[model samples]
Every structure is written in structure tokens, then in C-alpha cells.
Target chain A: MTKREPFFWITVSCGIIVLAFILLPLIEMLSAPSAVMLKETLKDKDVVRSIWLSMYTALAAACISFVFGTPLAYVLARTNFHGKRLVESIIDLPIVIPHPVVGIAILSVAGKNHWLGQIMSELGVRIMGSVTGIITVLTFVGIPFYINAAKDGFEGISPRLENVARSLGAPMFSTFFRITFPLAWRSMLVGLIMCCARAISEFGAVVIVAYHPMIAPVMIYERFESYGLKYSQPVAVWLVLVCLSLFLILRILALPKKNRNHD
Target chain B: MIELHNINVRLGQFRLKNIDLNIDSNDFFVLMGPTGAGKTVLLEAIAGLVPLEYGRITIAGRDVTGTAPEKRGVSIMYQDYALFPHLTISQNISFGVRYHAKAKSESGSRFERLVRELNIGHLLKRYPETLSGGELQRAALARALMVEPQVILLDEPLSALDPGFREEIRLLLKNLHESSGMTFFMVTHDFAETLSLATTAAVMNNGIIEQAGNVQEIFQKPCSTFVADFVGMKNILPAIFNKHTSRIGSLTVEMATIPVDTGGFIAIRPEDIVISTHKPASSMCNSFYGVVSAIIDQGFSYEVHVQVEDITFKSLITKGSLIDLGIREGLVVHLSFKATAIHCF
Candidate 1:
């Protein structure tokens, strides 16, 4: 009700338009079909299985990143060595490369007939047409988020804190787990959540890596191609609903606690 | 005992070269220097936080050149306290004790003793961010002391606290040192801190030790211009010494002895120069008549700057003496000092 400036109104109107451009399509897709269609999509066994597969593979991919990415992030944050910048850029390569290009790149190394694939097959860990392939592609596309986030978290911690711990009789390994990890846990958690979200929504790479064990995005594409709008739209809505709800819950969990330090 | 044999460290633009230092057992040795003088870096080297590019460090006669910080039995408290933000006060104090097997069994009693002695018993549940600077300092001190290290390194421990709180911690540290007879190596730029707490001190400049001696000796007889300037000696004049007579500009100074035959710099401490309205019949070998140029009230005393011909000599006078002499800017006064007071370097 207070008199607003002309520029203020202009900016507000532009923001609303952009917000509507994104929200309107999602709103239309969700409301396009009847509630009964959404229920039917939810009840479909293939739909249910694909959704579960996406969640499981995404979680697995996130776990794999957490195991390896943590130490890499700590090293990146704490030490300087030859080719450090080159290593960091390579980690960020997948985030900028096209998704299908990422898929082809993974295929070169992880495909069944490739050298690494042969080694993996010898070890009884198949990479193609298996859950491992899906996870590999998902992890490849998602690691940048985890490594970069955890690196930032580690950098946020003062090296003096670790030095003090060391001076006070703490071994280097214990210092990391006791002091550095706890201090950086919040940012690392946020990174893990981002990595998981990216993995869950992956489609192009997963389709090339493992087509038979269909994740949700591939199933959506397959339905749309064969059955057209009526059948596919409802499934797309159901996927969006499931992804959105899961994203909300995970993001809430990642939110810092109230007693968190202001710094 | 802590000894550094020709320690050299190159960290970007600042380099500490050929730094040799020996701190005796149970001595509170202070390293005083200007900012960017690598005082902190030297302390870090001793604590094993920085790699020594050359030379060796030995503690208690053991050559610990390649030893890790945890095994060195030396602890350091940083300028900003560096308390672990994730840990409670109790946990932070106990962190070191709990880590070492030799100390773990006795940690509980040690923790209680430290908390009680440091007067942080009631703040056990608090985090570092919730505590004041003084509290954080005490917590950090407790953490360092809990390890019972052979040597404790303090990096500008009082620089971050308020003046009143600085006094409080200064007294607390003094008492601890006296009671425990523990060797402490502290780095500070404040001369007042050095005077009050240091048993032996070193003056450093550009990553090199300029002078090292007993605290009072270092203050009264600075060996170099850098040491004199860094120690806040205001009257460093270019003088020519001949026999026992040193000529500084137009003022002829009679000293106990001359270090050089021709050109040298004479450093006269401000407190050593006595100011009066008239020349007194005393055994002061050097006296000069001058007009007061400026008067600065320094809380405890008055800094009276006197201009005799070309040179301005600074002298510290008690407030009561200032009142009696009624010295003001442009007022004529006489300055006198004993023959032994002039330091030539």
C-alpha cells in the first residue's frame, strides 16, 4: 500500500514473469490429468520399480562419491602440489560437458570391451548393462558437486585449528576426523545432497550406460515416445511429484541446526 | 630447553634466515619484533608446524629436526585462541589429554584441576563463539597446559584481548609461570608486555635476531638501531665518539666509554633522560639546555620532547615532576643523564 518506486514495480513484475514461466508448465503438467490417472501411474509396477531403481542408484552413487571425494577434497583444500589446478579442472569437466558426451566418455573406459571394463569383468564387477554402469555414469556426472562443496567446507576451516590440535598432541589423521571433519560436516552434507539430487535426475548418461534396468527418467522418455501425451504426461507428473517431495525432505535434513555457529 | 641451530624458512616474501635461538629451561623467553618480521613463523618452526628448510631444532638436547608436532612435546597457543568451535569448553580442554595414552587415564582429574585453576569451571558447556576473548584465552591456555608440554609457545596471546582483560590474563600467566616453573616462549610486539613478563627476550628484525639478552639488559643496552627503535627508544641520534666524549649534532655528550672512534649512533632511552627546570648538582656527565617542543600525557607519565639546537630529545617525566617543573611547549628546560646511560651501536 505504501507508494513504491516505478523501478521497483518493474523489477517485481519481471521476477514474477520469470517465476511464472517456470511454475506454469509444472502446474499445467500436474493438473493436466485427473487425480485417478496419477493414482494409476503410481500403481503401475514398472513405474514403481523404475522410481525405486533411480533412488537406489542415486544413493549408491552418492555413497561412492562420499568415500573417495572426501579425502580428495581435504587434500585440495589443505595442500598445494604440482598439477593441482589441472586435477580440479578435470573434476569439474563433467559439469560443463554435454550429458551424452559424458555418456560416450564413460563408455570409452567403462564399456564391456574396454581395458578398464575387462579388468572390472575379471574382478566379477561388470560395468555394462548392470547397476554398476548406472552408478558409474551417475557418479561421473555428480562428483564435481561433492568434491567442490567438500573442498569449500574444508577451506572454510582455519588451518590454525588443525595446527593447534597437532600442537596439543593430536596425530594428523585424528585431527582430520575429530576437528576438520566435524567443522566441515554441514557443507559436506549439503554437497552430498546436491550430488544425490543430480544423480537421481540423470537420464541421458544412464540410458546409454544401462538401458534394461530402466531408471525413472528413461522410463518417462520411453513412455512418451510409444504412448504419446495421455499416458506419458501422467507418469512425468508422478516422477516430478516423487522427485520434488524427496528433494524437499533431503534439503530440510541438510539445513543447518539452529545452534550452528554464525561464522 | 629449546634450541634452534641456523633455522631457515622461506615463506613467499618473508624469509627467516640463519635464526639461532636458545631458550633456557624454566625461563619465560619473549621474542619481540615488528609486524612481518617472521616472529610467528619462527614460533611455528619450533612447534613443528612449518618445515625447516635448513638447520635443526633440538628440545631437551634431543635432535627433533624431522619429528612431527604431536611427538615433539611442544604446544603453541595462537593469537586468536583457535579454540575448536565444534567442541564444548570441557571437550576442548580435554582434547589433548584424551589423545595421548600416557595422559588418558589421568585426564579426568587433570581436566577438573585445569578448569578449576583457570576459573573456567562454570563455562564447561559453552562453545568458543559464545565466550568472550578473555574466556577463550583461558580456555586455550588450559588446553595447552593440559598436555604438560616441555615448552609452551604463545603467539601474541594478549594482542586480541581488551586492555583490562589483557592485564587480567597477564597476571594469570605470570602466576602460572611462577607456580609451575614451566618454560614459556611468547612472541609479542608490545614492549610493556616484554618488560612485565619476560625473563629473557630477543629483538628480531626482517627475520633475524638483532639482539638477545636478559630483559632489563636488552632494554637498557640495545646493540643495534633496529633493537632500539623496536623497543620504543625515541632518542637515537647520530653521534661521533672520541675518547669518552661523544658529539651528537651540536650537543657534546660525555659517556663512560666510547665503542667507536669516529661515527656511531647513540641510543638514549626516554626514561633515562631526566628533565628539570635548572641543571642540578648531580653526577650526570651529560647535560643539555633545551626548550620543550611537545608534551604528551601517557597515562602513567608525561613524555616531554625537548629541542636542543637541532636534535629533539625525548624524556619521560612523572606527572608530579611535570606539575612541579610546570613544563609546557616552548618552555626552556635542562636534560641530564649519567655517563653510563648512553648506548652506542
Candidate 2:
């Protein structure tokens, strides 16, 4: 072993404090629940349904963002026009707005008095106390993460590659599918995971939009409020475990290929 | 054949103004200029990669000003090669066949021929990042040629290679052009490349085409001071022409033909001025005695700078001649040249 410097020890001490701050509460909650208590919590039908709903709604939100945000991300990466900076700022607005404010903003546009809400009502679409409302809130909060990540990925690729493809008789659409997408798909996948992880943890916006559907975070809050710490601990532990696995996968995918361990 | 008329393009703060050019089929045309002279921009405009603010472009007698790059019947290769990293060399070379029906039918035989001729057959399964610079260039050339376009544009294809690879690729390009009879438009800053490969050439400076003509004519009789300096004419001086004689500094030199303008510049090639220790009884129209001020060793030859009154004349001589004449700085020497050797513009 090499001799350590004073600065190295100081940095390690700071890193340990940060890590403990994040991991201590989760470790305590995970260890507080008995094996029998965890088994019984998994057997509960309501717990199962809420956890499944959270995962399903979050996945749906990620898919919706992927379908809609890709073209916008590519355009933002490749071209420059009037108000481009303003448009980029607007894309990031969701991250800065308060969660309840996002919920209220969506409700204002979807209420019965508004023209858009009236059209949605006539078309038999409801944005309150429904699965649709849950997905809408999740996607509203998660798409910024997806667009920013995907935009960086697209920017990493050289436009000269596309120009060469065009000179070889491939049209713009063909070049996107054949050249740009293949080179950028890994970053897009990372973006999808980031969006999904963020959506899975949302509480304030989804609770305001659709409290009855009872996703995982809302169930944990309800259990803690009605039945105190004992009932909520199991659910929180489960949600934490799910998030841990998601971030583990993200870390693995984000690593460069040579740094990844094959075994 | 390719023709560009009034080609005007504005990109950010740079602009190309009122440019016109005509390139015959089966011709190797090279564009030479200093850095930031819009040589690459002109190549991109010809390939339809950059939009023109106001211009008309025609290729093979058809107007393609509004056409897309894919429909322009031209292929361009960049200096970096720009090979698709995710694809194998085989896949990269055959990428264009899927979009053109005629190429699709003949792609197999053509692919084989290109790989064999370029000596890249063993690299078919490799990726671009693994290949050397010369191999990547050959792969890019094969990719551009796979479509059988009427014209091809190359942007400094051999610039990034070592000298041995550069010579190899240069010969390959010459042979390919000779056999295919396809028009080639290339951009380079190397005068040697132009001398060896260019049938016709043009010089650009600050987005304007300074001169365009046969390569030898442009070298021997450049139309402007910029062209003369760019082509390595070592001695260029401001002169006042009166009738058949022009006065350069304190010396008056005879001219074979007078220029249309009365007052302009005159240029002389360094090789045209001969340095002698003694005055010769030759029929040369101009002769001067000057002290040698500097002797610069230029590898294969030496440049002897002689000062004649206020004017300094440069003469290129071999090392053998340098040693035979015992030439050194501060030694007075005789400089003489024929009247026809002086070019006035």
C-alpha cells in the first residue's frame, strides 16, 4: 500500500459522511422489519396492487416520453434557430416548479371550465382520480430528465457522419434510423431509466392528481399517517429495494464497456 | 461536368461572394488556398451539403440547385474519413447500394473489385477505429465510389497520412481517375499535390476565387500578387512599366511584352535568376552586381539572397554550384536573367 496524504484522508472522511447520510435510514428501516412481517406485507393484496401500479404507471410514462421527446431532443441537438435558448429553458421548467404547483397547473388546463378540458370531456377522457391522471403527472415530471440526457447523447455524435450518409444517397429519415439512432441508443436507454426512476418516486404531484389509485409512495404515506411507523416501514423498505436495483442497472449501463466486469 | 454560377453562401460571419467555376468531365480539378479561405465550404456547397443564399449549380448538364444532396449524383469524402463506427468495413462500403437500384444489382462485383484494388480485403470485418489512417482512407474511397456518381469531392484525403501512405494514396487516386474517367474536385493547401495531380486548379482567398486556369499557366503566369506569392515566386516587386521597359528600384529591365496596365507588380522565379562570380558575355537583357546578404540552406538546394542597390533578388542554386563558386555572405556576385523570365501582372 502507498502512503496516504492528509488531503486524501480528509476527502475519504467527507465521502463516508455523505454515504452514511444516504444509507443509514434505509438500512435501519430494512433491518427493523422482521422476515415474517415482510412476508405478510408481500401477501397483502393492497400492497401488491399499489406496488404493481407504481411500476406499470412509471414504465408507461417513460414509454410516452420516449415516443414524444426523441424528435425534440434531436432537433435541439442539431439545429439553431430563433428562441432556441428560450425553448431549452422551457423544457427544463418542470424540474424547477414545485410538485404541487405542477399538479395544479395540469388541473387548471384540464378542468371543465377550460376549452381543452371541455374537449377532453367530450372525448370521454378524464384527468382526475384515474390511471390517466397518474401517468400524466409522472410524465410531466420525468420528461425533462429524458430530453436532457438524450440531447447530450445526440450531440456527442458528429454531424459529419450524417452528411456523409446523405452524400451516399440515404435520405434524412433513413440516415436517422441507420446512422444516428444506432450510435445514440445507449444514451437513450440511460435516459429512459432515469425518467422511470424519477417517476417511480413521485408523490406530491401524483397524490394531488389521483390519490385514490394509491401508487406505492401514496400507500406508504397513507400507512404512516393512519397506522404509524410499524405499518409503513415494510412498504418503504420494498420501494427502497426496487429503487436500488434500478440505480444499480443504470450504473452498470453507464459504465464504459472496458470498465465493466464480464463475470 | 460541373458548373457553379454566382455561388453566394453566408455561414455565420463568413461569406462566399459571386463565385463562378466550370469543370469539364474527365478532369482532375484541385482547389488550393490558405486556411479559412472557404475551400471546404466551397466543396460542401458543390456537394449540396450547405445551402446557398443565392446561386445556381448544375452537374452533368442538369440543374441541381434545389435538389437534395442524395439526389445530386455526387459523393464527398471528408478528411477525417467519417466512417460509420458501428458498421464493419464491408457494410460501410456497401451502404449506398441499398438506395440505388442500379448500384444494388452490381454492388457485389464492384465491392470485390474496390476491396481488392485498394488492398483492404483483409479488413472487411474490422471497424473504423481499429484501422490505420491509410486503411481508413481507402475504405472511405471505396465507400464513395460504390455508388458510381458522376462526380466525387475529396477534402484533403491524404493530409492526415504519413509520407509513405500519402504517396501510395496519391498514386491510387491517379490510377482510379484515369480508369474511371470521372470528374474529381479536391481541396488542398499543398502546392505539391496540385503539381502532381491537378489538371486544372484554382486559388481562393477570403471566399473569392483569385485565379483559375491550367495548372502550369497558373504557376508560371499568375494573374495577381496574391497568386504569385502563393505559388512561391520568391521575388515580387512594385514596378512602373513605360512602353517596353519597366523600372524596378534602381535597375531597368527589358520585357518581352508589356502588360495592359501601366503601373503594377513584376514577379521572378528564384530559379530564373543565375548567380555568377564574374560577369558573362551572354545575350541576357538584364544584369546586376550585388553583394550576397544571406545564404539559406533549403535541404536539396540553397537560396542565395543578393542585394542590388535597394532591391534584393533571390537565386536558387545547387550545393555543388555553391561550393564551386565559393559563395558566402558579404561577397559581391553577378546576377543575370533573360527578359522573358520576368512576369508582370
Candidate 3:
């Protein structure tokens, strides 16, 4: 009791500081607008269109991450192959680099200067300044988070389960789908949601690469720059409201309730 | 029929080499070994989970070396039971049954029958997390058996259970073996587990079978010093082999010894030691003058540690017998054993 004099006060102060840092902006934005202002913001054609595009592209980027990143994550989690360390580091490269750098690199690669863009273009596909370009940036920025989360999920699963599945008439792929995937799916779903959210929130790379097909974050930024606080606040509030709802739902769905409660 | 011929697989830091085994169509075989002795690897190899670098695996007379495990008609139930927590008991059982040629109705009926048989009919809709360890074990067995696999592999099926409930599971395993007549190849390091259900015993060490024989013969005769030690033989003294009996050492080291050597080695279990302070006139042949170094109270019996020169041999005596003998530390005692308990590798 002698030492308890100010410890509880310090804890409350820390909590207040964190809440001010994280929740204050959201509260201000939400409280700034009336119901009419919210409805009017939702009524904006460009805002609605960008929100739809953002949702679809974010989903596409998440799907892309799932396809390519899961197996890579599994390999990282399960096997020790040559060049694995280098591959893992490269997967995390987009996370640390500046978003504008990511944007520049994507534009440089898919802007007639690289073979991949040329190949896609040759196959009657266009990437630069298109919806595909937006998805490309979203996936490039968002995948490392997905891969890292999925890898940790897979890593937490005991290898014995996969081995058991394999021995129980499952091939390598069936073992993955039946045992490994289901066991790691909750965490993978969390990863996917976070990836989708991160991709949706992306502005810099999308702005550089595919600003014409404006996503929500870029639109928000554009409104702020062109017409200042009043024009942007309503759109920002609408977008944040939707994004926050989706994020909360996904987070609830992704929790391993049985595991947490049992422990 | 399941067989392995010259199977070879190299894992990091461990290698299984030139392994050969044959199990009858419906025999329950136990594979006993120390940890990292490649028991699970061998089971996985037979089940075709992991590819073999070199070997031929024939299951039920079909060459399944490159066959997928699903196509091979085999199932493995692991120590944790590996029951899918996402599915109910019945669904878990029926997940793989469709791969079999049985009609859907018949498969469903079969799953129902297995559920009832395993005493888990009430748990058909329950998630795996809700069930007890024994219940999960039953469900896992039901799932593996529902497919009517040609062979079932059990990897340390009881190692995860509470020790108090192990015997109950062991009896359940025994019942499964007897009632269904399914071929079960269980991998366990616990040798004292009931081999009554196992038609044959295959003891693995490092990466190879040290011995494979009838349970009694394996207990009675081991092929190597490792097998002898692993099979719970406590006193395996060096002996000079002369046919079926070997003297503990030449007459100089030990006195009045007999050998049960097969090729050139002998082993004696601790339970076979006969002790007396008054020097009983038994014709068991082997006798030694040693000082009692320690007395260990095992749950079932007392392990009397006796040191004869540099060699320390542990002899097990019952608690009642411990009372009669007044066994204590630092007492000079006369120890003796029977020739039948002495085995040669």
C-alpha cells in the first residue's frame, strides 16, 4: 500500500495519453458533422464511386496476397530452403521503404520501363494509371503484413498436425487445406482484413500510380487540398465510419475464441 | 499386408536405413523406441506421408511407393488425436469417407455405426474442444476407422492422456483391435504398455528394428544390448557365451554363472533377481557378493541398487518382500537370479 500511492494515477495518465493520440481525431471528425452533412457527403458521386473502387481493389489485393503470400508464408514457417532469409527480407521491404518510393518503383516497373509491365501490356492488359495499377500498389504495400501474420499463424500450428493429416490419406496439398489452413485460418483472416484495410487506407502509392481512378484515401486528400477542412471532413467521416465498421467486424470474426477462453 | 523393403530416408541429423518390416493384414503391432529413434518417420514412410529416397512399399499386395496416401487406403491417428476442431464428431468422421467407393448413404450409416461402437454417438454434433481426452481419442479412432482403411497408424495415441486414464485408453485400443479386427501399427516408447493386443512387437532404435518377435519372445530374447535395455532389462552384465548360458564373467569376476546366449550376448531383467541374507540353497546357479548401495521405492516394487566391484546392478523386490528382507542401504547381501530370465542378443 505504501508504494501504491501514485502507480494507479500513472497508469491512468498513460491511458489518457494513448487515447488522446489515437481516438481524439476520430472523435473530432465524427462529432464535426451533423446527420444531414453525413448524408450529403454520402451523396457525392465521386466519393461514392471512389469508395466502391476502394472496396473492390482492397478485396482484390487481399485475394492476391492470399494466393501468393500464404504458401510463401507457409514455406517460411515450415521449411528451411536456400535463400529463404533473403526472400523473407524482401517480402518485408515495402513495409520500411517510403510509400512514395513504393509508388515510384511501381510506376518505373509498370511504366514501359520493365519487362513485366511490357508482358502484361503485350497480353492485351494495361496496368499503369488503371484499376489494375491501383490494385498493384495496394497489393505491393499490403501483402507483407498479410504474409507476416499468416506466417506467424502457420508457425503457431504444430508440424505434427500436418504430418498427421499427411499420414491420414491426405496429400501435401490436402494436408495444407484440411489441417494447416483451417487451424491457421483465424489468423489468416485477421491478416486478410488488416491487408484490405491497409490497402484501402493507402494514399501515396495510389496517388502516384493511379490517381485518375481515385480511391477513397486519395479522394479525401484531394478534397482537403482543393477545398480545405469543411469539404474534406464529411467525406473523411463517411469513409472512416465505413472502414472502422468493417475492421471491427473482421476483427471479431478472426478471434480464436475457443483458444483464448480455454487458456 | 503391409511391407517395407530396404526403405531409406534422410532427415536432418538422423537417417533411417535399410528398414524392412512385414505386418499381417489384421495384426496390431507396437513400434517402441526412445525419442528421435525414427519411430514416427518410419510410420510416416509406411503411410506414404513422406517420400522415401530408396525403397519399395507394398500395401495389401499393391506397390504404393509413389501412390498418394489418399489412394493408398491408410489412415493415421496421432497422439493429439488431430481431431478437426472446426467440425463436429460425425462430420470429422465422414470428411474422408466419401473418397472410398461406398455410397453416401452407406458411408453415413457406417459413420453412425462407428460412432455408436466408439461410445461417442452422443457427441456426434459436439465440437472437439468440448470433448474430454478419452472422448477425442475415441472420435479420432472412429474417423480413422470409418474409412475402413487397409491399415491404421497410431502415433503415440496415449502419450497425451493423463496417466490415470492411460489404462482405460489402452483397454479401448485393445477392444478396437479385438472387435473390429483392424490392422493397427501404434508407435509408442512405453514398452510396459499392453502388448496383449499386439500380434507382434517391433522395437526400433536409432533408425532400425533392433528386434521383431512375439511379445513373449521379445521380452524373453532381445537381439541387441539396446533392445535389452530399452525393454526394461536392468542387469545386462558382460558374460562369456557357451551355448544357451553365459557366465557373468570368467570365474575370476563372478561365480557360479549360467548363460542364455543366442548369438553372443545375454540380458537379465531386474525382476528376476533373487536375494537372501542367510544364503539360501537354491540351484539358480548365479550368485554374487555385493554391497547394497541404495533402495529406491517404486510404486509397484522396490529397486535395490547393489554394487559388485565397479558394476552397479539394480534388482527389483516387492514391497512385502522388502519388509521380510529388511532391505536397507550399506548392507552386504547375497544376490542370485534364474537362468530363464537371462537372455542373449
| Interface CA RMSD, all predictions | 3.3, 3.8, 3.9
What ranges in model 3 sit over 4 Å off? A1-11, A33-43, A74-78, A117-125, A156-184, A255-263, B103-105, B241-265, B309-311
lDDT of 1 by residue, B1-345 (tens): 989899999886778999888889999999999888899999999999998889999999999899999999998999999999989888898889866776788877888888888999878888888999999999999999998888999999999999999999999999889877789999999999999999999999898999988999888788888888878788999898888888888888888876765888999889999998988889687888999999999999999999999999999989999999888899999889988888887
Candidate with best lDDT: 2
Tens digits of per-residue lDDT, candidate 3, B1-345, equal: 888899999877689989998888789898889998999899888877777989999998999999876778788888888887777777788777555666355876776678777789888878888889988999999888877787899999888898877878788888888887678899998888835557788888889888886887787677778888887888776666655445554432222344444335566788888777867788766678888999998898999998877777789999998889887889889887765666655
> How high a TM-score does candidate 1 get?
0.94
Interface RMSD of 1: 3.3
TM-score of chain B for predicted candidate 3: 0.92
- In order of lDDT, best first, we have 2, 1, 3
For model 2 chain A, give the 10-residue run with minimal summed lDDT: A254-263
* Steric clashes per prediction: 0, 0, 4
What is the TM-score ranking, best to worst?
2, 1, 3
User: DockQ values for all predictions?
Assistant: 0.58, 0.54, 0.41
Which residue pairs show collisions in model 2?
none
Give chain B TM-scores in order. Answer: 0.94, 0.98, 0.92
DockQ of 2: 0.54
Candidate 2, superposed: residue stretches over 4 Å from native: A1-5, A250-263
Stretch of 10 with least lDDT, candidate 1 chain B? B255-264
Clashing pairs in 1: none
